[model samples]
Target: MDIVQTQDLRKRYGKVDRVCDLSLHVPEKKVYGFLGPNGAGKTTTLKMILGLIHPSDGGVTLFGQPMDGKNRLSLLRDVGSLIESPSYYGHLTGLENMVVAARMRGLGMAEIDEALGAVRLSEAKDRRVREYSLGMKQRLGLAIAILGRPKLLILDEPTNGLDPAGIQEIRELIISLPIRYGMTVLISSHLLSEIDQMADVVGVINEGQLIFEDKLSALHALSQQALAIRTTDNHAAGELLTAAKVAWQRSEDYLLLNRLRDDNVARLSQILVAKGIGLLRIEERQSSLEDIFLRITGGAVSL
Candidate 1:
């Protein structure tokens, strides 16, 4: 069942539409990656989902119940979110900060140890938050979010600005939540690689538009198979291949064709040999997911 669903969700600011007609499906017990480039309205969409901000049109449903001004808080009781950044007192110790959050959430003090340990922050509980590293601070925020062991966890760029070690550490931690506590995680990130590593299902948004939504494998399959070939006479080879009803493109030193069958490859090799053309190289190639993402977004991410 869908733990969270949004229908034609839209958020408009003045003449600009930050999020437009987005419908998202987040399945239970799966990690959902809200993938988008920076400023593609990821945060806006997330805020609307959380009911922290209202959309100009459309609506959100959490746990099959539509959210509104009345039942938003109660509906969100089982949802834990760390949007953008987690707020904390710099001067306070980690445990002290968690204590405050526990009180706010009406959770018992024992929950603090559980949450901290889950995020591997228990050892740092006595350290001043201000003295902690950036990664430590992020873990602390995550600890607070998981304090009551909510059924759903929403995190926005949780690994943002962290080193490789920190990103991997957080990624591993997020990946474990579904089985450890049975959480359905919704993590938003501009970095495609991070989403590729962490998400089972993906929703891609770009330029305020919901471009693609599917399982990770579906996105990977968008760019079909191909063959990359280079010959001594690409100029003549292009004509011969074209005459043979083969489609291809000139890329650097190779002619990239939309996948030829095994028999077709053999035929092409013989034909080239008969034409007195030296076959330099011929190999199969698959389009990378990153390339497909750029193609689908029209390179709008760079903007």
Candidate 2:
């Protein structure tokens, strides 16, 4: 079942379109990555879905009901969201802040503790918000979002400000939410690596247009593969590859072999062996999400 659906959803300011005619479907119990460069209307589209803003031309449906101004409370009750940056009081302790939110949402301390534990911020539960790091603040915001235990969670840039370990922690947490708690997630982020790994499906937006929407692997598989081979004898490797009829290019001390194949590698290795070329390392690589984004958007959007 589709947890969210948008048909011709559009938003504009004067004559400039912030979000063009966009349409997408997010299945229930799945993580959908909403991707685009900076100012790709990702956040704008998300706002419309959340009923925080009005749509200029089209509208959206959440949990099978038409999303509109009148149904805001009913729709919002089942949804929990964190857009842009989560705001907190500098003087308030983490637990106090969460308790305030819990009371407003009519929840209890048990719910607050669960949210804190979900983000692994239980140890810092008593720390003041002013003392929290950027990553800790982000996680605190996440704790509040999960406090309601809503059916759907909409998070924008969910992994921002996290360390390597913290990033991985949030990644696993997001992936496990649906399976462990029956929650549906819609996350928007500029980090393609995180999205590629976390999202079950993805929607690419650029210049306020929904350019592509598909499964992460499906979109990635549409591009060509490249191989990065590291060897000491770059000159000799290039010569051997050419003599073996394998196409390649040089990048510093590495050789980039386009359309690299298993058979091609075997043949090239044999040629290198005959030429006495020293072997160091060999690995196949595909065009990364950033590569695909550049190819599709003409490298207009900044990272």
Candidate 3:
């Protein structure tokens, strides 16, 4: 089932287009990575879906129903979101903060403890939020977001300030949401590595437009693989490659070729050996999620 679907979704501010003709499909019981460079309108699109901001044109269907002013509140009852940054009062204790959120959502107090436990914040529940470390605060934010166990979870940069261990904990927690509680998740992060590991599907947005949306594996497969070859005689190898008219680039230590198929590798190896250019190592290198993302976004590096 598609938990959230947007058709030609557009958002504009005066003369600028924040999101243009973006169609997003978020499946049920899976994590959908909403990827984009900074100021690429990811947050804007999310806000439109949550009805926090109105779209200039197009429509949004969430939970199998149109997301309009009339039904937004009812629809949001089954959704939990932490956008941009989590907001909490500095003076409030962690447990107190959860209590206030639960009360607003009409959730049971028991859920507060469960939420805190899920984020590994139960031990620090009594600490004032102001005293909590950045990572701890991030976890507390997550705890509050999951308080009601909403069917849908939308988290934007949820691990923004976490340490390595905290990142792994949150990653594991997110990956388990579907199997453990059947929750559909839509997450946006600047860290492509995190998205690569956590998301089943991804949507790449740039310049207020979606450039690609598909399974993570499919996106990876779309990138061209390079064959990295290290030879004892680098000059001879380059000369041979140039003579053969094969497309290659010479790095300081190795020759990088675009032809990476098994046949191509075998043929290249034979040619190099026959020419007495001893091959030390040859390996096929697939592009990382970051590489693919930069390529799709016209080399716009993520902040």
For candidate 1, lDDT tens digit of each residue in 239-285?
Answer: 99899888889999999899877998898899999999999998888
Candidate closer to the true structure by TM-score (higher is better), 1 or 2:
1
> Highest TM-score among the candidates is held by which one?
1
Pairs with backbone N, CA or C atoms under 3 Å apart (clashes), candidate 2: none
What lDDT score is found at residue 145 in candidate 2?
89
* Residue 223 shift from truth in candidate 3, angstroms: 3.0
Query: What's each prediction's TM-score?
Result: 0.97, 0.81, 0.89
Give the local distance difference test score of model 3: 0.89
What are the lDDT figures for the candidates, one per model?
0.92, 0.86, 0.89
Instruction: Please give the TM-score that candidate 1 achieves against the real structure.
Output: 0.97
Model 2 gets an lDDT of 0.86
Model 3: what TM-score?
A: 0.89
Off by over 4 Å in 3: 229-255, 260-282
Model 2: how far residue 275 lies from native, Å: 18
For all candidates, the clash counts are 0, 0, 0
The true-versus-predicted C-alpha distance at residue 70 of model 2, in Å, is 2.0
| Candidate 2 lDDT over residue span 153-225, tens digit each | 9999878777898888889989989997799999998777888889999998898888888888888787778
